[model samples]
Target chain A: MGRHEFLESVAVADCAVEIEGDDLDDLFATAARALAEVMVDPATVPATVERSLELTAPSLDLLLYDWLSELIYVKDSEQLVFPVVEVHVTGGSPCRLTARLAGGPIDRTTTALRADAKAVTFHQFVLEPRERGWRARVVIDI
Target chain B: MKTLPVGDCVWEIPPGEKPGMRVPARIYASEALLARMDEGVFDQVTNVACLPGIVRAALCMPDGHWGYGFPIGGVAAFRADTGVISPGGIGFDINCGMRVLRTSLTEAEVRPKLAQLVDALFAAVPSGVGSKGFVRLSGDEFDEVMREGARWCVRRGYGWPEDLDATEGGGCLPGADPDQVSQRAVTRGRDQLGTLGSGNHYLEVQVVPPGGIHDPRVAKVFGIEQPGQILVMLHCGSRGFGHQIGTDYLRRFDQVMRGYGIVVRDRELACAPFGSPEGRAYFGAMLAAANSAFANRQLITHRVREVMGRVFGRDPRDLGLGVIYDVCHNTAKLERHTVDGEPLELVVHRKGATRSFGPGAPDVPAAYREVGQPVIIGGSMETGSALLVGTAHAMTETFGSTAHGAGRSMSRTQAKRRVWGEALIKQLGERGIVVRAASKSGVAEEAGFAYKDLGEVVDVVDRLDISRRVVSLVPIGNIKG
Candidate 1:
């Protein structure tokens, strides 16, 4: 299992979160959940709707960055708030990722939103491994 | 970094203070403001000084704070022929700005219905996360909006012709090649037009108390004619369309800058020469997004008018609900300015800053030429906002720019922890401000205590003669996203 928490004082007018996971797949999946939490409580989303995503990036870090950005893109283009994220990553210099997402259309009446996050920023972005697990810090422009 | 007092409300960090700095950096702030700024402000502004082809000096206004690459309130200019353009300098929300509308009705007449008006606005103008606006545009229509800006809105009956006159750049930036805009960007922004996105975006109904008029003569010219006059002020930006474009260009710049032999202190400051193919494409796309933002504000203005008209049972024009001014922050422009008495065409970037062209500049509208351009500074919901006029001094001192808002002193998470939304709403209601919001967390995140005192920020710019205060407006009702 992976975990995430919001950090204060990192961004003047945005959200910064730290996530930890058991492995690469866990980290990527947890990152999606954390990004979704920035907007609404995932527990309220019910995981009733499902979607799939596939992406390839030159590097693992860029892979994670684009994965989070894809969530924002989906929120805007598809008008979906994904609460559940499952990930499978293949190791290589060019990383490959396939994600399964579950959520539904955004309705103000059903889900209480916290903020309209603009983009996932590269300001002080860090994704690295600690002694026992992996740790990532991301800043989101709200 | 060593900083010395260089001028009135001005501080300078010399190039010798850091390696690779092409020019010194300047910050417009009083001693108190400097003390309150984060230590990161020095690092961020100094990092900006190291960028290629930077001109005169890198500048951070009184409201400066740490941003992705360029600090908020950051201003820098580069020579067009030899310079670079970075998406970080313009911000993710392209053309994020302020718009003010003046009403002929008095506060006494509107006070009884303030709550109703706020509620109506909250309902009519779609706001908050994932709330789509009423607009539905096809691909062709949306492209027209990308090129025509607010003019498209007016042609489709969203606004009046005269409204464009009061808008900056007449509500459009020319040479907007929609072909340069990405299909993904269009998909994100097409239907989002007219939405007031959450996180500090808000629409407020305010009043000009008799004693709050600072410049009586100029106030009358800009439509703040009578005491107790009610006004509407909104703060928002281009939404997801601009975000996608900015994200797209920023990533591309990061990948291409090395090929151009440009090295930036931060990845977010990545750039290519303004003459390069990459840069030109980005400029075109950015202009398109900026145009979309102008149209977004205009359409929102239409919604405000409709809501106000229904509440008052009068024609919007009959209520004298005309645009006073619309000014954008987080933008870049090509302008002619003189440095050392030498005329130069420069690409000026203003992120979390406002352009304050002087009275005689051709850019200032005919109606405001004598008093200078109107600069609107939005404050916290509790402290209120102000309408100022640009000064000749700003043109010479700070590249025709000034501070945009009261800089945040605390982050949103900290504010939410300190103040519960429901209680804050109750407390504000007791103080006569009617509050309507999409979510309680949204309200708490924007707690007034999280922001710096608006008066102090205004006083610094005022004392520097950059922009002079004209009228102060306190919020009577607010629709927060």
Candidate 2:
């Protein structure tokens, strides 16, 4: 199944995405994929290198913001795009995120960067339980 | 949602209009422009009015639009002793601003070679997403740039020392602590000193069309001697460095706001009191990022001169290329202002507004103090831009602030759906404007129609006596990222 889908949000001047999964861990993984898709064409980037990161925030919503923001920071600073993602969330008063990102250095010859996703905004950001599973929504500042 | 007419081209949202609003919110816009403004702008402005220690009313310029927290083109001042500082107020692109340089050559002299000149510029100036810059600074050198700004560029032989005199705050804001900036931000900015990033950033070659000078006296003071004279306008900012700083601080403030007993309506408006340790640290880091921006623009200016020199077969100085002025649109500066019939020191936050000090103001450069500071308004590539001067009226009403640009009326996605990049390129070509862009999608996103009419926006400010138009420049060529 597809990890995530794009959503229309006029409230933000930039793009938004909705990720669906069976649990919190799945939701984080899907959210990471959605973030990567916003920056570059997913099919073009090969999962040649793997990197792992851990982040902690006070709540699930903030954990999502931190996770996505870290991706942007990695892309801009290291010029790499992640196509494969694995996320695990440990639920507590202080939420912690462990993510494994797999991608390669941006080769301008083949990889076409669609948008420069500057940061992950907190505007209307949400991660919650749904009737069927877990759902997350994030608006990116492009 | 109710608005009361205050004065010519002005409307006010009374303090009571919104719960928690401590002061009134005023907007400068004509009837037509007001109607087109997004309803969210009112909410954002009112929300800003509720911030702790905000002085006067939260003011939105004619170009105001709904942004993340504060509306773009929003200006507000707060008492330094009690106010809170929010990175959102200054925006992610710290010191994102405009700079204009005039050349002795005229439109007629350069029209034939416009394509070649644009190509040269496009190559000389690195642009677009993931683009690296020409200057690769060592860690120590990068720290110096954070502390010194344009002055560092001048010392490195990238710009003339005199250029600093023509810049806002002399191109460097004091209290920049390089140690406050994170290592990640430093790494991101190390190779991006002279780069132009994507999304609404561009370097345009423009001309002052015949009879475009609005005020002869002001134009003379601005070094604009004749109509049809060529000028270069570059719009960019602190790049990755500023974005990282803003991102880092927003998260930090969001966590600490609870500790300070501060509650903001929006998380994006997260802040800490000015006297708090977190607030001082963010301010210091923000200044460092702002300095990096000044140095970035200065380096680009140097590159522009180098390219022009090569293309025209003359020395850059021989071509009479000199900076008119460089001003920031997004910043928070510690300034003194008169409020409630008393002089007070405050921190003025201009999100998407420019500082427009009036004639005889101490901040205005000595050469142009009699006329006033130049307020650069960059419009779309297809339309044109305007040069305006600050007025005394602005100082009293708006903390000496003015609109930055023709605010976006359509989202980037909507704009792309409405216009085809190839077709727009052809249309601009027919209008005698040459454009070189790295991405076709970016070109489509920045279609001229996406923004409100600059003429109407500028007119509102002019009628309100916030700023007076000096000259209008029509674009002949542009290089977009």
Winning model by lDDT? 1
TM-score of chain B of 1: 0.99
What pairs collide in candidate 2?
A: none
Residue B388 alpha-carbon offset, candidate 2, angstroms = 0.6
State the iRMSD of every prediction, in order shown.
1.1, 2.0
> B240-290 in candidate 2: lDDT tens per residue?
899989999998998899998988887788999987999999999999999
- Structure candidate 1, residue pairs in collision: none
Candidate 1 scores an iRMS of 1.1
TM-scores computed on chain B for all candidates:
0.99, 0.99
Please provide TM-scores computed only on chain A for all of the candidate models, following their numbering. Answer: 0.95, 0.91
Which model scores highest in TM-score? 1
TM-score of each: 0.98, 0.97
Which runs of model 2 end up more than 4 angstroms from their true locations?
A1-12, A18-22
**Model 2 chain B: worst 10 consecutive residues (lDDT sum):** B437-446
